[model samples]
Target: MTVISVHVPKTGGSSFLDILRKNYGAKLLVDYGLEATTALAAMTSGEHEIVHGHFVADKYVDVQGARYITWLRDPIQRLFSHYQFWQRNKFPRSPFWRQQYYNNFTFEEFAFSPAVRNEQARYLGGMDIKTFSCIGITEFFVESMELFSKSLGMDIELDNLPQHRVNTLSKKGYELDDKGLRAALYEFHSLDYQLYIQGLEVFKSQYSQVSGCLDTRFWDLQKSSQKSFPPQFSLQKLLAEKQVSNVIGTYYYGDGWPINMWDTFRRDVVDEYLDEVRSDGFNTIILLFPMSLFKLKSSNQKAHEIFYNDLVFLLDKIRDKGLNFMFRLGYSWDGFPLSGDRGRVAFSVLCEGSSKDEFIEEARQLYLIAETYSEFLYGFITWEDLLMFPCNRAPKASEPMRIQLATELGFTGNSGAIPERDSGEFLGYLEFLDIKFTDLFMDLAVAFPRLSAEVRVDTTPYNDSDGGEHHYVHHRQFVETDCDVIGTYFATYMLPEKPTLNDMKRILSFVHRQLQVSDPSKKIFIDQLLLVIDESIGKGYSTISEKVIDAFVKWFPEWLDANSIGYATWAFCDYVWDVIFNGTFRYGPLGWEFGGNTMLVESAETRYVQMESGAWLRGGRILHFEPWPQRGCIQIELEVDDACSITVELSDSYTVELDKRDMSQVSSGKRQVITTEFEIVPEYLKILINGGAAKIYRVGLGKEISSCGGRDLNMNHRVTSRLIRELNNNYGGNC
Candidate 1:
């Protein structure tokens, strides 16, 4: 049996390779020459099978009655993912998607013209056309996967499957209109739209019966998996229980991605990694990765690598810089462990299958890889996209997968296997040791509690509250799924004309109430999140409306109330552009969620910190401050130029109907002094340190604009993964 596995970026290739060893053992070819095309020839020489890796076209030719299968995504999303690959590796440079909104308030540029995405598909042999028996639309993956498995007469358990490995920030997210339609039409063209429609057909076929027809177990496991052993008590309870925090104000999905960075560069001008933490509100940052940043890299490949490496170094350096940080861990293709990646290990699945590490040396190899940078490496991870839990084809079971993993550790005795990571049973295993791979991460978290580390790796159950894929389940399962489905319904329907900060807040507010009683792990996650905002929200920036601020703060109000979170809205930078162009982040009353960092609010409720943020007006200008959370606050001073007028408000308008109290303002020479204060609503109100409105002023005289926040959040701009990693490295976090 020739077991071939194609190593795509986010596919489940790793887990499949593990399966090959169980069924093929030594017969599996592990030599590079035996991979891909050479497999057919190699198989003739012996009673053997070839596990595949990175086999694009030629490998599957002329195999009599052989099953040919693969997965695909909407062309637009694929391009974005592919684009990110280059950006992370440094091929093309662009601002992150979100940052563009901050500066331009438009996602039109980053969007795929239907023509481009479809054109790529047409070139890729219509793979995007659902030409295979097991065509999988990643969005409805659970069902597609199950159907594929069944077609091959394989039984996969759904109880423990991982979900949403490949993530794409929707170009058409939120609501839309004629302007939106025309823009998409112009940008995407007919070909891309056709691919999308074809893909939609596949999505509807298998997923209509259930939300995603994924193993319903995902919902259950998502909730049941992590139990902190003996039920952790409190911050007081956790006096004994240990924790972890993974921050990702800046995570690199792939290439010129985050296109927001270019603008962030122009806006924030990120110079160092810690500088990024400063850019994101300091304290600590949890940077995430998948097997995401692979060979091709991004447009700024060298620069991105430098940034990534700088961050690795900065993880430790942050401790020196007097800031906090975290290290996030995740796999490239799905939540699968990259260390066990067969493609990287042996270059192909066949080679990997034939060369099973009798002792699974990969874990040790992983530790070594992680150990290179002793400075930051705060903790392990569950990629942010992992939140999109449960698809129609959610894994059938982890038992088969677990059994394979057990063998990796050389489980000689039938009692040696442990529970599978996702689902299914390692029936032979009875030994439950504390030193499993889980321990590797747990040890790191405990050793660095200051970083408040934790993993949101598993798609805990089908929660109605989460975002992305898991959230999709609620609608698909309840409303209707058909062959014609092609929308993501992001609660945008309830939005108003000209959304305001209050409107954004109301929306996020609904998200808040819906998620009020998060699982213990999520609560812990939020705390560390707040701690992050408290320490560093000062120097970095955001450029959304007061409504954007309201939306952001409302989602994690607890952190705000706890004085552990803050934000910078990049308003100062936007103001400069606004002055130059007569524009503002204010949209609809407050709907200004652009791409990338434009909505820079991740893990806000995932960790703890003591932070405060408020906007002040003096000399007729507005000045807002949001601190990172999980830590306490301190007073600060600044200097300003003469001839500027400013007015400071304690809060943004769309949310938090303030009792409207009056307070006194304080001042200094050119710079004024403001202290973060707690409000009756609990969160610290904005301090009035407004330097007043004035023309652009220069600080740190020679710092590069690219080294600071961009002049504005450019839609195509992105705060590089390099910068993000740098922050983690300095603050003491991930790789």
Candidate 2:
């Protein structure tokens, strides 16, 4: 029974999502609560049997072997509901309200802005959405839900309808007086008011108020088949435990990019030891190649070819072992597969006013790479800012004419261009530049497929009513509450002052939770991705501390889920050679130092991992041995049954009930931490013992977990990100 519901927010769409969850179990779909609207809805297609969530267009509505259904609210009422939602949330710096911290809206000023007036009017008119099959008003939410059930030859009970899916801020945060809020709601929600009136009129002529023609009570059958599911932590543990291997392999490095001149770009030599890369069953590699963006220079430049060739050579070897590759595509900037042409580097500025053709030509060059290489490519990255600005309702299709034009050239645009912005501190003096980047890019997505980017932020540096500066006073309450930079680009809030072991654990956890998906094929991509991050980021910054570095290395399986984020990395050492590299586990002495005899050893790869405050600590060497005869089993303890809880932080997707026990598993003994059981069959493809060095690549844990110290990720070596350096430094270590 495949269920696909194309959800359009506001028209009580969540009511249906809630119902489906109650019946089918919440794990049936990705958890929207832990993610932003973009990532929450990423990769979900309307075509799936029961894939439903704010799917506004048909392109996103396609389902394979499933039902196709949708519900819509009266246009005007939907518009007003949208308006009220913004009003309820008090538009964060919306032009109509206040871009400033104070409630500085002049009634007249609020009444004039396009987001407030024209856009609202378009919404209220119901003129924007025309493709919905069952259109009704919120007043008839129960009936509409009934119609939805009947459309699919089923029955439902409306009693379990979730009240207000979006949990909004408290009254104190909105900063609105009761009276003022009432006024704003009344004025903005006018469409709902009028539409209700009109809908009432229509209902009178169509059917009695409650004639019992349909089963409203039966709708409870739709009570999320998955509500109140088990915690995903168990599944997370299971996954981490299953991804065992002594090697930290690299993906897309070795491409001899000039920027990587400082590290050991030896992924090319990794081919001599596939057994080592496949060590401990955690076989990983970072593909080293580039999109056509810099094809001209990459092909022509000697140094660039050397690095890229090395990366490709690694890929060919990894594939030879019949292993899948997780290809992470870097965007206009952000150096993963280094570019020979510096002009192509990230944060690149394109003409905000470029014509459709110009944008398409360039965009086409990029999009084709993703489309053409979809098979080997496990994830098609939307952006690399890794920095996202948290704001609801990014520029709609009608906006960003130029960027929209770029999308018309054929590529989906995303609203993740800008990173999270704080209320007081500006984005330096580049606010204008940020705006330009978003304005032009989003416009392109509208015209093309979808545009995406990244975001980063920490909830520190804030003020209270008391207004006493408590800079780093060591307050857990403050870390969890006060001074937090809400609306973080990814709603990311780090609690680090300097890189720490806990920070890496936090980031690892964050990425896994946000990247959960229901497909096994997707898991294959995730398995490959882990190998990538270990390489790129791990290799790029090699001078950091061991605690931070080890923590990152120890708990790397955290962020692996996602909404279409593939991964890869650059350079790495020999897998067999590095497995036994960490002989004594010295912070400074650890890491794949330039010249070392990579050998397999039994060790935990020594890094700090978070535990339940009083959880028993079995301190000893955690020997990473091999990938399961199967794929995607993290090197940790996990349960796979009835109701499973799991987190894939890289994609920021979390799930409570994951009974799917086919793909992975883990095991441990008094001292033997070996990964032999796999969620695979035939038992022939598991990781085997081999003598070789490991490789490196860049795969992101679909999350933004932080170090206990809450250090910044951008800086080279605060203990927080020292794991990256440590991994790179000891490019020849093994578990």
Candidate 3:
């Protein structure tokens, strides 16, 4: 029982194919390209319930008891759409002659071309119009599909049979307003116009005969299938039965920072770093590795070996520090060119379509390495490195990628048809990438059971040919991966400018909901919690004030605890390359000294001052100016009792007092901001905090005074690290 569907170009066949696929599933064979006929000849009857693609009707006429079907459109409109589609999308499989004709000829020239004059009729070939079991009119696509479904006893629901539009043109049709051109096109496509009219007549006749038949078949199929279908696996139930370990983690790239840290591999530095992280109450450490380190290129072989050894050493050190470790196996930018030729080679390989195999093989090697230290290994994470190109490129499917995608979409024959950007098929292409990514994760998960699959949280916006835009978020990876944990990044772009506590909460809540919608059972881990954003480091980042930083540190952890979610700072320590602002107090309290009755209280969060009425905290080197020096003002954030007053003195030249009138009520205490002027200097600036009983949280200096406090550019890292540590102590459970 073979159904041959001849999918003539620009005849609404692509959309129709989706419905057929849903109805027939694996039984539908997409026979595309010139080789389709030969491929079909080799297949036996009943092997495929439906054979659909771009082949002439006569090609399948010999099939025993086969039913032929096709859709036809207005010849002039179809020609115009086909031309527009070709202009937008490159079809490598298109015949060279056809490509040349379309590339060189005008719309009028193409419409009058003899080779494509009667495309619809030519596709039907020697087959008679009345011979088609079902001739669908593209104009009435929904009704035609319904009729075709009923004629074949396919049980397709009428309500579900919506018209699927693909490769749509901006213009509705050829310039029919040009009467002379329209008349010329109509005359040239007389045979196609006649074929389309005849097809429409056949469609109307079939639809009339079946329109009265109650659509009970679909309901009947649904009822029977429901009984036979197996129960779906419930992730929620699995999660309810198991205890999810809360992860309080930070990413470690070693002392060299960012790229090629293994190059300067120092056991003492890493050991001390891991010890500091462990002492700070971090239970987990995610090691960041550049993909370039694992490339099999001869030039990088020695570096690869060294990296492997360094990784093992770090694992041993992490185990000694009693910290759990996870591997993040792909950071594409290793500061290429500036870093060295090694990064350049790796970047090139990642961009190439042929390097997918190498990428997978390298990942397998990483798994092997982790397997050796499984005692400390929590799982592996992929850092937006699943695709050939980095996320910034907005990569399209290359020819090889499309060929693989053809197989993924269940196409049986090679087809050179590339989907137009923003078309439904193009969306499918993005989904196909997600599937490939999940497949890779699944492969690794088999060996390491506790994998965390990272979801691409950023939505890609695309404008259709009609000047309409839509955004797409890839969630297929979250939905398909069997891993128990899902990973995502929280960056500045996700928040509003000068965000408040409510804004951060709203954004995080939205992200969480989006992931939960995909799969409710999987626990989410904020693998890269980007607390401090530098606009100069990355594009489209928003700056936050010290007040926002203070609020985030206090509230974000509590929110995570209430929700049973976990997170890791993106950069536990500042990177050498200054790619991102540091997210830790790694440098400690560098240049400050306490005096009088002021007592410095040090904890896992931060080092702050507890002062008495006569206490004073003075610092000769309160702020350092690098590269050059300039005049500026100093701002400080402090908390005190309602009646308390604090005086800020800068080099004994300027002074400001913050009293109960200046303070605002907050959850912690009455908070106040104090700002004072300073003079230009080539050395560190001096400042003093004296007078009333108060607690100082932050001190900062900058050229101008705004509402925002200007702390050390890296102080946000201290706030971030402190919050993470606090979260870990309060909620992190043993895995």
Clashes of each: 226, 207, 1
Q: Residue by residue across 321-371, what tens digits does model 2's lDDT show? A: 644444333333223223233222332323322232344344444444433
Which candidate, 2 or 3, has the higher TM-score? Answer: 3
- Among residues 3 or more apart in sequence or in different chains, the pairs in candidate 3 whose N, CA or C atoms overlap within 3 Å are 583-717
Mark the 10 consecutive residues where model 1 has the least summed lDDT: 579-588
TM-score of each predicted structure versus truth: 0.28, 0.30, 0.45
Which prediction has more favorable lDDT, 1 or 2?
Answer: 2
Runs in model 1 deviating more than 4 A are 1-228, 231-281, 293-311, 331-497, 516-559, 562-735
User: RMSD to native for every prediction?
Assistant: 26.3, 26.3, 23.2
User: What C-alpha lDDT, on a 0 to 100 scale, does residue 491 get in candidate 3?
Assistant: 79
lDDT of 3 by residue, 1-735 (tens): 678899999888888888888888988888776474565664454567788888887776667888888888767778878777766777676584466455777776667766677999998886888988898766666667678888887766667554344223222544455646555665677677657655644665576566721122222222222222221233233333433355678878665445434433455577767776877677778876666544434444544555566678788888777776777765654531122333333334423234544655676677777766634445554535555342323235575765554433322221433354645445544554454454345444445444566675543366644666645455444444334456777877777666777887877887777777744666677887876532323445566665776566767766676553477777665543312111111222323456667666666445457777766665423223252235465556577664466665544455555444334332247565565555643233333334446776555444444434221343345655565565456555332
Model 2 shows how many backbone clashes? 207
- The number of the candidate with the highest lDDT is 3
lDDT of 1 by residue, 1-735 (tens): 333344443334445455445546786654334554466766556566554444553455555444445555544345555545444453223345334434542334445323234443443353434444445555444565566555554555545444443222222423333555544543454554444444444544334333322233222221121221222213222222323232233232111112112111221122344454454443444444333233213323543343355345534454555554333433323211111332232211111132222112322333444455433323333312222211111123255653454344333333333343232222112111111222222333333332222222111233221222231122111111111101111122234434456654564444333332232222323312211111122332223333343344444434433321221111112111210000111111111112111121223121111111222311112112233223222122233334223332323541221112211343223433332322322122222323332221211100112222223233212332233333344433433
Over 4 Å off, model 2: 1-249, 255-270, 273-276, 280-318, 330-377, 382-454, 459-500, 503-571, 574-735
Better of 1 and 2 by TM-score: 2
